[model samples]
Target chain A: MSALDSVPTAVSRPELRAGEMLAEGGEGRVYELVGRPGTLYKAYRRPAQLAPLEALIAWEARLAEAQPELAARVRAATAWPQAVVTQPGAAGGTAAGLLLPRAPRRFAVRHRDGTSRLATLSYLTADPGQRAAAYGLALPAPVSADRIGIVYALARVLEAFQRAAPPVGHGDLSTRNILWSLERGPEVFLLDCDSCERYSPDGEALDSGHRRRAMTPNWDDPATPAGANPTLASDRYSLGLIFLRVVGAAHFPLQRRQRDSELLSIDFAIPPAARRTRSLLDGAVVWSVCARSLSTRDPARRPAAAEWVSALEEVLDGLGAMSAARAVWAAQGGGTPAPSPTRSAEQAADVRVRPVAMSGAGRRWERVRPPGPGLPALPQSTRPAPPAAAPTRTAAPAPLPAPPSIVELARTGLGRGGELWLGAHRATLASLSRAGRRRRATRQVIGCLVLDFALLAVIFYMCAMVAGVLLGI
Target chain B: MVNVEERYAVFPFYLCLDASASMAGTPMESVNRQLPLLRAAVGEDPAVAEVIRFGVVTFDDVAHTTLPLSDLSLVEAVPTVVAAGRTSYAAAFDHLRQTIEDDYHASRGKGDRWYRPAVIFVSDGRPTDDRERWQSAHSRLTDTGWKRHPNILSFGFGDADPAVLAHVSECKPHRAFIAAEGAEPATVVPELLAGLIQSIVSSSASVYSGEAQLVPPEVPSMTPIPVDELD
Candidate 1:
């Protein structure tokens, strides 16, 4: 009742006469507010009024009066709680949902022939981002650079959100929450701010516990206690997974025979799926930060959101995509050897069939499904989920990881905490150290092998030059 | 100037299947079995997996989307589509029209970079509905004056006419596949589906590599079901 008194309570309760239903999610249905342009009302399905949400709602109301600029920024970055919709239903215009502002123009696309479509981030992954609406290319093929740009946009938004006044943590951060637009610079609309974690400056608690929302099991960190809430560190882990998705989306790392459960993980030891991703990301500073460093299951070990911002900004500057990728090398001490040349499609295809391929048990295509006793019985969740609507590709969710920073890997050496986390694969760090040593030796051997090839190539060129000279005479 | 380089969205892929009575037994069974395999294969082939959304439209007496355009990762088991009624190409097209307008090209319709959809249509018999209705639906699907229309790759088996299949394939005779007469659909259907997967992969790969054209693989057991042959 005190919380109700604090919020703008309705005298007679607002009626929904106009405006159609825009979209529905885990929280409630959002309806375009009639008469009042650029605003939408969300009416929750659940009438239960909880205390945690009351504090969050009160904080938002206070922000509107106090730091409006910060509130505006929060709204721009995410659908921040603007006003609690009180529709006439049961006990006193119950706090149904919060009203959200309309998405920006950059959050949508227009067809060449003149039509517009709101674009979600899925355009970058599961759904092909290519279309004739590209306005320039008449023949239809997706542009490859755009996906990178979209991911880049995501990084910037997350950075902005994390740096906000009280600092918003997307409790449910995934591709589904971010709508994108290629019409301008990777413009996006961040949905469901109600579910986002917003702590009071005075340190009050807030949680959405969005279990009912569509979240892939792969996204959840196994280390976090079963009932514990997702933290900012978990958010970083999620971002890192996205970084991998962007890096390797062109060629997913799912081995031909690997199960979905195997795909869900937190260990960042360079899985086969990451090998090519590592190669493609070579030279980029963030690659070291993201692939080598931030991916660790250890939240303390992961870089803060601000660090990501600075690193990504540098990546986008006159370095990586600019000066022919010259300034894009690893962040100095991340001594992971520079990747070899970027391979062509043929080379990638060749690697797929190689007998001694992958650090794992080889390619997915090679795995023959074991029959009878050979295959162990799996738990029910591992079994495919039951029938539902067609799986919307744009809503693809989750990624797995747990890795060490190049700094820590060199310094503390996977720590006591990391050792316990590694469990059965406790020897992984030792093995990795051995592999690192082996890699050094192999690099030297490969260097000599390359030199030998170079010498032979020089001789052949010389012979050819002589032949050309003789022919001319 | 707006940065065109950053403008992009995922490629939308739709499968328009004919579940009319003619394909009831072996052909239908093969479809149910092989479709999941096709999806799994695509998942393994990253070239296509990253660039395309998978959707299905099955038509008999009516056309309904067994699956809306969905993320492949979200896809689990293929719904066992039971065969019934008559082939209504028009109904299928109309349903797609509604889906595109309401779902695909809704409120936020079309500024992102999207590859024109590539549709794979399979038929084992001729349209049971009125010719005008099918033609109207066909016209709407092929029309590009308003928005980008999808590219269709069609298959004709049994009594499904070569002319209609060619038409559905946008008169591209090369894209029309016809199974040999009297052949067991259980065997022939798998080959056709394999070819369809190849085309989908190639089309998606083109979005990145920019090398190949959107073309189907040459099916060993099937011949070209050209429109001229029927005419």
Candidate 2:
């Protein structure tokens, strides 16, 4: 059965206008709507699969009236559905998807393979040291201020979302779904609101096909009911796991101790060897939140999203603003830092990185180990020790206020057709891209988008043609 | 503030196959079809895909890495194999040593955790290379360095030499297998592929939580070859 098909609230959308296709997901395809820049049309693969489109749109429409204060904040914080896009049945179309104001560019970063995905807090958390050093991957500078900034921003967004009139709930929350940008301090982008859970006519949870979204056997919250749909408490549990991934260890401390391998999760318990790094974040705010949320076997006992916001705010209060908190750590770094070289640094330098032959050289048996056992310990350097101190707190001299959002755009314009808006803050899009550079980047992105969509269209057409020939349609 | 550094870890799996003239025609055709099926089977399961990376290397006159580790997800079709030249064991071994060294560190640089790599070598004919170069490369590939070393499994079919294949399966005597000479290409190739997929999936399941030892799952129908007769 189609997902978005035949909802009781299934009203045809007039907003489904002509548009240039932009990108495609398994369930839906996205388009840049005609006459509308910075807005997209998501056409569902199985139009019926997007049944919740009406619910999300209706929920959002009610927000301005229900909670005026949070309406604007919620709108800015997420890629919530603004309107639904419909295709006429005469043209062989159904209830497709939504018309969403595109998330700003800065929310995404390019992967090694040149494709860009929404940048998430997980990117910063991965191989924080070596990956950062070797591949130029970035995370918040190993500073508490930067890390705390990420938590505070996310908590604020979650609080705003939960405080909505009906309390919007994202049924699936993975690191990939939450985008983080460290550029203008700490900013968050919560994506794919389409998959969020809403209530049916009977007020029963309307969660289906979500088992396929993001289920990790080792990492999924055990608190989730056997076959029941996602609940708000479960979202909190998942958030706690993300925090664990951010700060210290996993929900369970197990290793690949099978016949022979020891492939430890990055979130594996911090062994005594990693105690130094653990001490720095273990007793901190994230640790407390993670402990409380994860420790509870029951979801109801877990702290609410607003509580997380308050706790994080209190933590920030202890050190003051981001700059003041950073100053406290900087002062501590000045005192009793270890002499230049450590065993780990020397070991990292000693490690030999043989160059792969770009030509017809020694590239015989490229290794991709088969399924079997007996894994060895990962390199010591991959788990480098955290630095000891950054002074606790320092008073910060007040910084200048940001220029008007209009100036922010002229400084780096991001609209289509070279159009510029005053005071328009584009977060996910890189700020370095200026007038001409921004256009080039946008063109490059659009080029990739068009090629992929066109290819998909051709494949679908050919398949339909073949099916018609075979079935004599 | 804690620098909670997390390294992304991937398990490496390599298919080192002999692409000498003997493997031309049906055998090569069988591989072209089977390899893609194997990749699809493993990829359909998320647990295996997240942990195991895949690569392919074929040796005839020389060993060439036709696919890299990350190519597992990128490739839509199995690579085609063309038969020509003499099989060179040295080229395959030496290339493996160099590749393991380069790929291991580079991946680590990108913050991936390194697992003790698994290498499967299948030969349909005996190596025609000089012994000296073969020994040197063999030593490096089986150095037990853990970081650079690979857990090698060897397989033989047709007129292949069982002794040489045994040496390639460095860890133990049980890791080597030989397909029956009279076996049909279509059936044998698919069976071998099925076995390999099972090995990958089961081993990956163990990577995070299973109690089973990390032994290479034995290919079901293939016969165990004798390693004692090796020079």
Candidate 3:
């Protein structure tokens, strides 16, 4: 059946001309609307897929009525279709195109060569050196806090997409389609919103057969099979990839690596420098979410956009604390501050947040942790302690060493024996018959037999020495 | 931060123009005028220019690389081509076969991954050489065993033969186009080249679309020459 035959005639139909052509994409031509200053027209090369397009517009309208604030945020960050443009004289007024707000000037960056281009994720996903050479603009370091802020912003947008009644999947969330900017703020503007696939309110896919499902190379979700429709799961998968690539500032295919070997870890995909620099991805909370989202084949295991938002928010908060602490230290003659009594040992160990001296500045301080949203505390034994303060008055007896905190106790307790006994008291007894225990017992028996042979040899040597002395006399 | 060899995707397009004596006056002028627009269209958009590497190859009795494959944004200006000598499809095909292989390895060394190369062939006259010689060169250029064999799109006008143009494009439907009968070279040349600018821009955008395709130009003044169905 023809694509236009399925559109309902009752829908409101706006009109647009061929107009002044601006740019042509793979699917359509973007044109400037005559009277609408900030609005542009995107005319499909083939007849427009009205069902999904209308569904997206209707979905946004419903969102406006229900949640105006969220609707505004989505509208500001994305080029959502404002209306559908119809051919003036076609039968039943066939929809020919869509009118969308133009991507704002803030999203465009001027290169050193004086040509202006949209600041897409392509500018963000490469090395700082290469990006400068190619785009003529130096980007923030891969481990920069601003890069995490950008990922947090993107997660919020995807969270909004998931919040829709049926949810809309972009299907093709790639570097080229999403324009990014940190010029004004950590923001991203989505283009080609009409190409997004919509679902029925009951959570069933309403994708018609007319529109071709879009996916960009390298950015395509490895979990999604060819010819299958895009789903919320796929979108979540894409979001995970964007997070890894953007934060790492390298285009390592995490999914492809996982496909090759299920044992592959996120560490293999992450650059060694990023790992050493202790970027936000190094934290257990954020890294765990990214690992779960990409390293598994089952879509059900992937973390949702909302999960990403929370994780990113927590890490970014930790980064903020680190920055504040650094500033405090820099202000107070650049020295390592002593650990605060109120600071949990895990916070001191994991996040490395040292307590700044309040006596110098005469200001009260609140105890701060690295990140506060239920993050797992990582264990470490080799981190150096802060230097002790020099004695100014009469010498005093040193206090007994402080007892181990619960985290340190747990760590030490776990390490004392190479095995962990869970559940019952008898579990350790049961483990004694295991292969490892057998190997240990066998090694002990072999050691005792060798020791006995050595003792006998010593006795024999002593007796032979006495007999030799008697024969000489 | 990662020292990964991040290779950027590039879509290489070779504009293989027929620069025979017949194309000198209006046809050649139209090409020179329209070629710069391609640079402007691609160079202005860094997103598109990042992935597209374009070159111009002009041929008559002998073929010459008028422009080496390069990023449009990096090129200062496109050099103009002048028409002379009789048409030899053999020279064009042979030159293209050699150039594509050389270019592919050179580009790969510089960390560029390529989509299949696209060859846009434009001609105003039929080949003056024997069919066997040209066909052999064409076979070598389009050999399935060769990884760099380009997808060719043929456009013909004036004294050019539709059958040969069809053969040049391997008789692929929508790949071969001929100017409508009695259309002036001045009118046809401009429209064809203008359409080609849009075609190149659109095709380059497809590289980002996962399945890279060779999009044919929509020349309003021309019509597609239908290929005969094989028995």
The best candidate by TM-score is 3
Query: Which DockQ-derived CAPRI band holds candidate 2?
Result: incorrect
lDDT of 1 by residue, A78-131 (tens): 665556555565675256666667777667545343545455443344223232
What does candidate 3's lDDT look like per residue over A1-473, in tens digits? 33223342222335344469988877888998788779888887766656567777777877776765556657877898877777656555346778888988878888766878788887777566655554467788664666766776667677778776667778778887888777655777888788787666544667656656757766776666666666667778778778767876666544444444444433324323334333343345565566566644566556667777666656555555344323322321232322221211222111111111112221121211222211211121111111131112112212232467999888887676334322222443445456668765566556555755775797799988998898984
The C-alpha lDDT values of all candidates are 0.54, 0.56, 0.67
Which lDDT tens digits does candidate 2 get at residues A1-473?
33223342433556446477766656677777778777766667766544456767666667666665556556765777776656566243345667677777877766433556567544554334423332245554332455555665565566656766556567556655677665555666677787666644333465455434443334444555435566666567666556555433112222122112232222323333223432223444434444455543445666656656555544445445535333322321111111221112111111111111122221122223332211111111011011121122112211232345876666554444233222222321443355557766666566556755876898899999999999999
- The regions of model 3 sitting more than 4 angstroms off are A1-72, A80-102, A111-115, A125-143, A163-172, A192-228, A249-275, A280-284, A313-473, B1-10, B113-116, B128-147, B162-176, B198-211, B223-231
Off by over 4 Å in 1: A1-16, A48-54, A57-72, A92-94, A111-115, A126-153, A163-166, A182-184, A199-205, A208-229, A246-284, A292-296, A319-473, B1-231
What local lDDT does model 3 show for residue A257? 43
TM-score of chain B of 3: 0.95
Candidate 1 per-residue lDDT, tens place, B1-231, comes to 111122224577778888888888889889878888876666433335556677777887777666666545344445566687788887777566555544455313433345667687888899987666676667766777636567778877788788778878777758788878876787778987887787776666555432235667657777887567645
Worst 10 residues of 2 chain B by lDDT: B1-10
What fraction of the genuine interface contacts, i.e. the true contacts, does candidate 2 reproduce?
A: 0.03
The residue ranges of model 2 lying beyond 4 angstroms of the native Cα positions read A1-24, A49-51, A90-94, A110-117, A199-219, A225-228, A247-286, A320-473, B1-9, B15-58, B61-85, B88-231
Model 2, position B195, has a per-residue lDDT of 80
User: How does model 3 score by TM-score?
Assistant: 0.63
lDDT-based ranking: 3, 2, 1
Task: Give the C-alpha lDDT of model 3.
Answer: 0.67
